[model samples]
Target: MIKYIDSYDFFACQLDNQRCRLLALPWEDVLVAHILPRLPLMQLFDLQRVSKRFRALIRLFFTKRTTFELVGHHVPKVAFFSLVKDNNVLRKLLLESCSSWLTDNDLLPVVSRNPRLQTLDLSGCNGLTRHALVAVSLTCVHLRHLAVARCDFVDGPSLRSLADHCGELRSLDLSGCCRLTDATICYLAKKCVRLTFLSLAVNENITDESVEDVAKNCRGLEHLDLTCCLRVRDVSIRTVAEYCPKLQSLKVKHCHHVTESSLEPLRKRKVLIDVHPPPRRDRLSLAVDCGPYVNIQPLSARLLPSGLNADPLRAHMNGPAKVSDPWKNHPSFPPVMPHLQSPSHLLTLHPSCLVLALRCSSSPSLWSL
Candidate 1:
């Protein structure tokens, strides 16, 4: 119903002036204020060919454009230039879809024109190199929210340039940017102290140094993502929990070194984390389940006679080895005496009693003992 109504209103302006005069509202006001804003960006170009009146009205609409979002759309070069031609008051420019063709030359002019740009989301824009970011840092000083996710070509220098210039940045997403290192992150943490949300997910190079700096410098941080950061350990997580009191969400998935020792405290504070704490177990059950501790030192075969067997000692030192127990079916030993049966029983027996038992078992007359 809405599409039909909009279609009718769109074609109504194409009619002769005498018919347009019959309408209650003015044609230009209706098209510019109501009709033009509803039409797709590409449709506006076709509307321009309708008449000189529409072309002028579309241009006027572009002049007042504040937010131009073409996310996931395959915008052609010529069409993109045409859409942003007269738009200078833009506050937000989201061109995540134009990554395939968006180059520095194509984006610089728009960035230069819109100095008041507060939010720019160019995530997955792999074709764009650091030059685009440099231009943005220089031109869009008011930039507060920036997302360059998966843009691996973005290096430390470009980020340093951004941190030095855009001190007001609040939100940043650098996830999957493998080229970035700890130096870049630490530098950004100190410079962009106002950052409230940051993601370094899938970047294995970042460690405790960078994260600790971020936690200390960006104390106002609310959300952080460290997913797949294999080098990140408990120290960094503990630092984050200590420094960032405002932290509401933390993603530490796939960080193998980060254990419950650090995460348990954050759980107490009610900070949402991607990983779960380990289940509790009593110390006695844990110790029994773990079995006896052994410190087996490496032995040299050169020190022993060639015919001598060292396998039994090695097996004994490293704890029990699976084998047929010679005393199990012996007529002198009772099967009901379970402690004197298996190799595992050695862990519980006293050293002197074991020695005495072995000595007594050597003689057939004392085997019953």
Candidate 2:
């Protein structure tokens, strides 16, 4: 059985293929799990070598959930076609029995039958090519939340399949999918309209144009991560604000072209956002001075640009605290408030008196806070 892979999800080669597997049970016994189509992959890996009869039985395990589970657990008739309720959460569908059981053609039947499976985690399934993705997309109608993080052998065709079928897909992680190109990303954007969380950290070939596609197709997307993508720029961030009105978080570390203006939308946006930028002038850093709106300081922002000084910043930061007692005394985490435009707009921190910040003052940017 496959094991030890998770992060909520990692952005790259998520499941390590050390060429060594550590399952607690005897190998031969697992393949014969009482169930067929829905047998826990952990059990099926045990019986493949027993005989030709077991091999034939294993082939049948790739059918409907009812048929698969018949050999193992009984499914309630009422739950036959239940759909996933959480559009944001990831799904887990076991296909292969184990790494050793993997072969070029072994996973075909399972792939052909698992249409609309939300999360098909064939993580250590190194033997599968991009073709399996095509098969799954064609069958899995509820297909959303896909994670092909480490199956390096599967390439663009896998993405092509997901794009073709899983239009309602919400979360997709392509962290170690290094071979992807803008054409593939554009294809995904056009089809996946409900995508909320997407991770494409190490896909070095991607650029700001990919962000354009995400914004246009997935308007409700809440979290977007481009951690190690080297080509992203301000146009990408701008596109995000314009297209994904529900966007709540963005991560763009190691992207050299990004700057403070990349986040100018935060000042105008009605929603709160979590952003990871280029250390300096990142929204995360700005969050410290704008906490009433649920802002957290940027993870980086070690040094302000040449002309900015901390004293003016300190004074600007202190201005809001002086007038907004609620924010000054509030707990570290607070409930989200809509219509929030700035640190001072939060209902929890409404000002008792008018105290306009000086336009030319030392902390003109933050002093008004």
Candidate 3:
């Protein structure tokens, strides 16, 4: 009975050893196809030092991966090259954060390899020059969305090269590229007619001509940012309002000449603008001219059309329209002061009081009769 029990125990030990030796799936297939691919790019570097087999598997994994995004990673030049050297099938390469050290030599090789790239975001890559831009334009013709924002080294000729080659570009962000001028923008507008999202923000060189050209040519433009473009005026805004029917959002912040007159049409169309429309100068001028003696009404009633009488206060409100004596005509209207009948009484008030009264007119409660 003791010998039989020893044999059974020995058989059980052998079975357990066999089970441990044989995996459910092959190790190579499991690591290369499943595990390595799932691991983050940075972790793969640590995993590569595990063994020769792991290093080979990581290389194989990168060769099959379609997207490589390492935003804000302080990747060394050598490490960046090593990670991307094996990756040739990349469709989207986003390395915005590595802008500090990323150079033409490091980027050109990757751009050359990945001809099928659809989106490339290298925003803030000030280290790169027009050579990098030219290389990307000439090589990655399939690019649709490209963001080189704050890459001030990019010049007009490289952009022209990009526009010429990548005509199918849909979204392009050139914000903070101070070297770009109106001519570059015009050429881009003419070539990239399929653009739906564009930004020329922070470039003071951008003027009404370029903006108007973009509005007319890129009618499909949905999102446009012209922030800090001081030269962009009301004319270009009006042109945009007329031409860009599909425009969804517009950013004209810091545009001094772009007033409510041009933006009113866009407002009516429900297009979202980053800057709030300035108060109508006409209304404020009229208010100031009327002086402190006039009875102030709700701003809404003052802006109402001559035919529209929706405001209940319209009957009592002392507005701009020349009306007969309301006290005699409408019994409900309050009695008129002596100053209401004569305009000369307004000029008698001190200049400081007039200024204070104008400021107070903004609030109905603070207004003096």
Q: What value does the lDDT take at residue 283 in candidate 3? A: 31
Candidate 2, poorest ten consecutive residues by summed lDDT = 79-88
lDDT of 1 by residue, 101-205 (tens): 887788888998999999998888887878889989988888999999999768999999999999999999999999999999999999999999999999989
Task: Please report how far candidate 3 places residue 227 from its true position, in Å.
Answer: 0.3
Off by over 4 Å in 2: 1-101, 267-369
lDDT-wise, the better of 1 and 2 is 1
TM-score of each: 0.71, 0.49, 0.70
Best by lDDT: 1
- Global lDDT of model 2: 0.56
Stretches > 4 Å off in candidate 3: 1-38, 278-369
As for candidate 3, its clashing pairs are none
Question: For residues 60-90, could you state the per-residue lDDT of candidate 3 as single tens digits?
Answer: 7778778878885787777887878978999
Candidate 2 per-residue C-alpha lDDT over 74-96 given as tens digits, one digit per residue, 9 for 90 to 100: 33322222311111222355433
